[model samples]
Target: MSPLPGPRARGHRLPMVTALLLALVGTLGLTGCASLGTAAKYDGGRLRIDGTDLSFRLPEGWERRDNEELADALAGSEIDDELAERGGISSSQQDAILDEVVLFAVGPGGSSLNVLTSSEALPPRAVLIDQVESFGGTDVRETDFPTDVGDSFAVAYRLDAQGVQADLLAMVIDTGDRLSVITVTTGSRAETDRVAEVIRTSLALR
Candidate 1:
């Protein structure tokens, strides 16, 4: 819709859904671990499924990061321009929310993962549908993804900007407490397939 906003050498106009995937991927691929050393709730080694004792392992080479790294990534990104042009959330607002709750992962070959959750009392299914409904992308395809834990939702899409295509996979998992939005973006379809395999196979009950 917004002409894809000048295809950043590295970035996306990430919103809650957008912000979680696009911007973060841009940052991870754009800059190295800017945070360098800090701990976040969700480490790349394993992430606990909320409202359950189950925890799943992230694929090797995935590094969990802190918000500071995200901030650093955004500093060198064109994500702001994309967001502005797309009529998405302001950088400041995005920054604030990002600080509150976001589990990030930087993986091999310019791939990234973003996790966002809310503790506010609400139905998980409703929130998941809301997130999916709000998503906007090119060549979008969605389906149910079955995990060892349960049936989750997955969306595959392409975000094209400046001739650079970001192949993305967004998986929404609802175990109980609240819905969890996990997004993965890669530089190509092959890469996407590899990463998706790692996630689907690696995600399991602790």
Candidate 2:
């Protein structure tokens, strides 16, 4: 594993998943239209997150929730060292822009699936996985795979946070104008592998 890069002005050094959740919760009050107004449609068991052209099948038994609902649930929680100096603006200020972020979250029982898009371009895969593990994820393994859209970067890891031990499959896909981080969280590695294949096959740009 590479050394954990020092914190950047945009806090790129923070794990993408952890950093984004905290940032979203903090800025929810400042956003009205962008955070709550973005459109997502579900048709034929597939969900299309508007603006990002991210569409994928909703895994068996999984249900989708809007990002604003997530922000509301997580608003009171505080995360340390994750939001340091994001764009040299106050964490709350940086979070205010989260209205522009696109997020799709699904879960079945104790597992979850997330698709997120932001204007910020992410670093390459290796660096991204390292950053995630550094932020309390363990047993990280990189999985390179092919997708209909293009080359895909994926990582399998276990995250123990808030008393939950979540097995996660994280994939990064660059869509020219934004970066999409798709994560599948479950208790079984077999399940993660199975779902990862479905996501890669289904992903495409519109």
Candidate 3:
């Protein structure tokens, strides 16, 4: 089988792992909503993501989405090809789903911040690189930086396909039982750097 397209692939093509992550996030939302009885709250200029012990300060002019919106965005998308085949839909079903999918996003379309969680306990570095490579990323690079919450590793790469050139910054944090993948996507390298830096520095774990 041919490899799945990356996040920024032409049209609505997103990687299988990404689709899996989104599914996980949706499950977290539903499960958390039912049991936790809490929702994302805004206080002191920060948007605290509900359903989990995660929160971040929202950057200037940035917007925050709720768990319901996230679920809506990932709705009807299979987490993997096996599921897709079993469901009798195209393996790339997410391509059509993403056309209307918008998660807990911040910033404009060209540049934005997205967060997803995984239950797997893995090194942040491996998760970061594997995510980029899995999405058909090229010119991948790794770096580290300090954040208000803790030290985190970042993976940056480019996706140039179908005449669309987009840059992505995958900021990964391994918080014991879960992996937080915060992606910053933009059309220009400078925008990618600027947006990611603002959000990264403002992050505060609570």
Candidate 4:
């Protein structure tokens, strides 16, 4: 309209167009960031074991496996049929039910501990300590039966059970209705000691 818009005016219009495109891009980026920030929430402590929600703090960089796989690894000479008969279930069902029994003993240098509900009355704390010591190949460094935390005890030790050597530690927490035993076995003395501390620090019910 005014002098038909000279070349200089056209160049100015191009810059304005570029500015508008930049603004649109910026707006889109902000929207994306906001969406990502407002994503769903989850309880980090809850782990899915055999489709069951079991709460525990997962150690960093450790891998998780199913019960069947673990049972196969720690099977020994135990017959699947015999195990199932005790629980009135098939081998496959028993595998699913006991999936959480075996946990990470420590990859490479770790051993496995099978957790089970105390079937024949609650065994003495000394019995557990002795079993762990015998299996771990280490003496019990410390044991404390805290009355406050479900009358459970924390046991620390160094073990060299079988060919695999490790620093083993466990928290035997029994809540009358349920008993949870968290055991950590390290590959080397140093790694075992480090993980033992981590397990102790990360120990919690919820």
Candidate 5:
């Protein structure tokens, strides 16, 4: 060969090619890592519901609506009117209808509540738990109630409704003076847990 193409020319070209390849590899690796991390955080199409800082990841193509307006509209309504307006169906036809559901924490008492209108009244806790277990595809977990709030309890369950299954967790805190409840509903158990965890972590007994 003619001086092996000259060391100066070959060496410079080789190092530049090597550096470009390394940079490309690094870029690809970073992109893959980011994708994996997002997938890991996704948690099967769920969203977290924090107090005021509600944050969670929803499933692709799923529509989410905030009912803050409805909450404000329905606040302090007697149960009958509340149910009627919420269901938007004749009382007789309310059976098994999965109406728009509302989850809210009332006050310092931390008594979580879920309000839904159905033709038939929901069963008691035991029966509700059984129904939830059947639909949620997971065992129900009961959490300890605060001692200060006697006879109040908190429970979390998974639910399948409207072709989508999600996690619904509620905390019922009843202080004799007042009742406060906090509830979080999410598209997945993981999302529900994340929201509930954040609420629990940031809870202030005002």
Candidate 6:
């Protein structure tokens, strides 16, 4: 058995893990994501998303995905193949499910964030626990993860058996009327902190 990851490998924080996701934001491009309604643009100095109340601007160096075919956009990245190889998870299956929930994505693939809305309503913590386990998560820890998303039940963990042995940060934000999931995965533990910070400040509720 391998040794558990140190604190740095654990992650910073975010919303919640769902199906363990990614795709480089760079490959997708700001121009490609420049569609009319769903793109992440500062409206009156606030970043807004089309389908959800959640909003958060990407970090200075980050890119936003405006594409409707989120999974296909992600398919252009290497993270899925890594997940498949390590966790025995299927990329096509993951993509199919993601296509349904993905509202916006950030990053350049190796490290990234995905925001998806769900109405599954199985209890926030329960849903969070189950999804992490499903994605082969390990070393799970509850987090205060820094977010404006409101009393989020967040967690950080190693994406066990997947993604080049990377870290994952997830959050489950429940607004009584809706639930928004923020999922991030990286090729290294180091990326987790930065991505989590992105999630923390990303929400721009409409």
Quote each prediction's TM-score: 0.68, 0.68, 0.60, 0.50, 0.38, 0.62
| lDDT per residue as tens, model 1, 52-103 | 5445566777777664676665564575556444435676765665664456
> What is candidate 3's lDDT per residue for 87-121, written digit by digit as tens?
34564554443333333554544344556554544
Report the lDDT tens digits of candidate 6 across residue range 88-174.
447665554556555555554435566666554424465566656665667877777555655576777775332135566766675
lDDT on C-alpha atoms for all candidate structures: 0.57, 0.56, 0.52, 0.40, 0.36, 0.53
Per-candidate alpha-carbon RMSD to the true structure? 10.6, 9.0, 12.0, 26.8, 27.6, 11.5
Candidate 3's displacement at residue 153, Å, is 1.1
In TM-score terms, candidate 1 sits at: 0.68
Task: Report the error of model 4 at residue 24, Å.
Answer: 62
Span of 10 residues, lowest total lDDT, candidate 5: 30-39
Where is model 3 more than 4 Å wrong at Cα? Answer: 1-16, 19-44, 66-103, 124-127, 148-151
Tens digits of lDDT, candidate 5, 27-112: 22222221111112223343433332222233332233333522333334343242333334443332222123433222111112
When sorted by lDDT, best at the front, the candidate numbers are: 1, 2, 6, 3, 4, 5
Error of 5 at 176 (Å): 2.2
Candidate numbers sorted by TM-score from highest down: 2, 1, 6, 3, 4, 5
TM-score of 5: 0.38
Q: Is candidate 1 or candidate 4 better by lDDT?
A: 1
Candidate 2 at residue 154, lDDT?
80
Candidate 2, residues 59-160, lDDT tens digits: the string is 555555576755444444343223333233455654553444455444444455656665555567667666665556679888876677644678777765
When 3 and 4 are scored with lDDT, the better candidate is: 3
Compute the lDDT of residue 32 as modeled in candidate 1: 42
